[model samples]
Target: MTKITLNAEARSDLGKGASRRLRRNANLVPAVVYGGDKAPQSISLLAKDFAKALENEATFSSVISLTIDGKAEDVVIKALQRHPAKSFVLHADFVRVVAGQKMTTSVPLHFINAENSVGVKQQGGEVSHVISEVEVSCEAKDLPEFIEVDLSNVEVGQILHLSDLKLPKGVQLVALAHGNNLAVANIHASRAE
Candidate 1:
């Protein structure tokens, strides 16, 4: 996983009015960094810079190195608020990360060789992905940007479940035993004309 560097400034003001003012004048993004033993600190970041950092899909789950007033901190994005009409970021929540501690995050899934799968090519079947991402628990450094699912030999009517995934080293899926049925992909038979 790669780290995104963002510079933030501590904001002492609170409330909707102050946030709106910041957005109107400076084009700043109101955000909060919480978690760990420290109290959540309210901060503001440049809207353009923050938007650039968020351009990557992995930004939501990947570890970020935040530089606040020259001090660097390891954190992960926990939540985001975007404008309903324009889709611009309105607020963001970040969680502080501690080394050696396990973190839970949803990692994106990428399918490979789906077009070449025997089920689709030979059996006239269609591949349907049930889950586009899965929640995983692991050390921040062990987090994978995306999990690849292979469909080379999947046959029609076969369903790929969470247990069938081959996770990276040190990564573990977070789920109850019964939840393992969460299907990742399925091959459906196609109708003949």
Candidate 2:
């Protein structure tokens, strides 16, 4: 709930050709907002503003206040298509945040105390991150900025799965709930000569 807001305008032009023209002519990014009880709406946002808003990593998981033509609504970023060779975003997809409803979004994982962990500091082990982010299901209010994985207690040859990390209240890992039990990080013996 970081009061981040992006100003947007409804776009009537549809299809791939129109989207290309919009990007080339006006430097606007085409986006769509779907989900909840309302029908999907096509919109356009300023390229610079869109890029600026996404500069913060938390913006991807936190609830965003999207202002469209003076009207405001809460949303969560679902997907983003970036240019293959460029750093700019080409298209964006968002899901409308409905009160009392669960929304699934990806949040970054923060590994703490890796350098001073039992594996690295005491056992000459190196940490390997298998995944950097995880998809979670929770209400907008329960959405976490990032999940923290503590490596201080970990030992060499230990692979911490998604369920090993402590999640916040009202937050649940989507993969864990489905029995995926993905490995988030691990500590292994150093291969350096």
Candidate 3:
């Protein structure tokens, strides 16, 4: 598990005006920490620090230690609002993580052996990643950085679904539990003529 830690300051100044001032003058991103048994807390993180933490894809799925006002809390990235064109994070939302509690969050999917898969190696097929991520429910300790999809034996025209995935112990696919077996990826026959 990749451990990530973020240092933040509790934000007393709230609302659009204060947020704008923080971003313009202090280069901070306003965020909220909610969930668990406590009331929501308003906080602000340095824009560069936030961006740097975000540089790691695992930061989204792994448990992050957010220290606010000298106290540390475990949280997961919930929602992020970004500048439409600039693509920089504007506002962020995070949900507190409890040790024994289960949380629902999306984790990136890694397609392994795609180039070596029988379909691509001998059948002239290409791997099509229909989905890049999947939502899962698990404890903070069981949360995975990524789920691997092995395509070594997949044949051409074979479609892999959510239920087809081999999940780690304690990790459950939200869609599969709800009876929605979504298509994950597939090996499509090459169209090259």
In order, candidate lDDTs are 0.90, 0.93, 0.95
lDDT of 2 by residue, 1-193 (tens): 5778999999999999999998999999999999999999999999999899889998998889999889998998989999999978999998999999888899999999999999999999999999999999998899999999999999999999988999999999999888899999999999987
lDDT of 1 by residue, 1-193 (tens): 6778899999999999999999999999999999888899999999999998888987877899998888999998888899999999999999999899988878899999899998999988999999898888989889888999999989999998888899999998886333665789989998778
TM-score of model 1 relative to the true fold?
Answer: 0.94
- Clashing residue pairs in candidate 1, if any? none
The top-ranked prediction according to lDDT is 3
The alpha-carbon root-mean-square deviation between model 3 and the true structure, to one decimal in Å, is: 0.7
Model 2: colliding residue pairs: none
User: Number of backbone collisions per candidate, in order?
Assistant: 0, 0, 0
| Candidate 1, residue 42: how far the Cα is off, in Å | 0.5
* lDDT, model 3: 0.95
> For candidate 1, what is the total of clashing residue pairs?
0
Local error of candidate 1 at residue 104 (angstroms): 0.9
Candidate 2 overall Cα lDDT vs. reference? 0.93
Q: Each prediction's Cα RMSD? A: 1.4, 1.0, 0.7
Q: Work out the TM-score per prediction.
A: 0.94, 0.97, 0.98
Query: Model 3, 1-193: lDDT tens per residue?
Result: 9999999999899999999999999999999999999999999999999999999999989999999989999999999999999999999999999879999999999999999999999998999999999999999999999999999999998998998899999999999999999999999988867
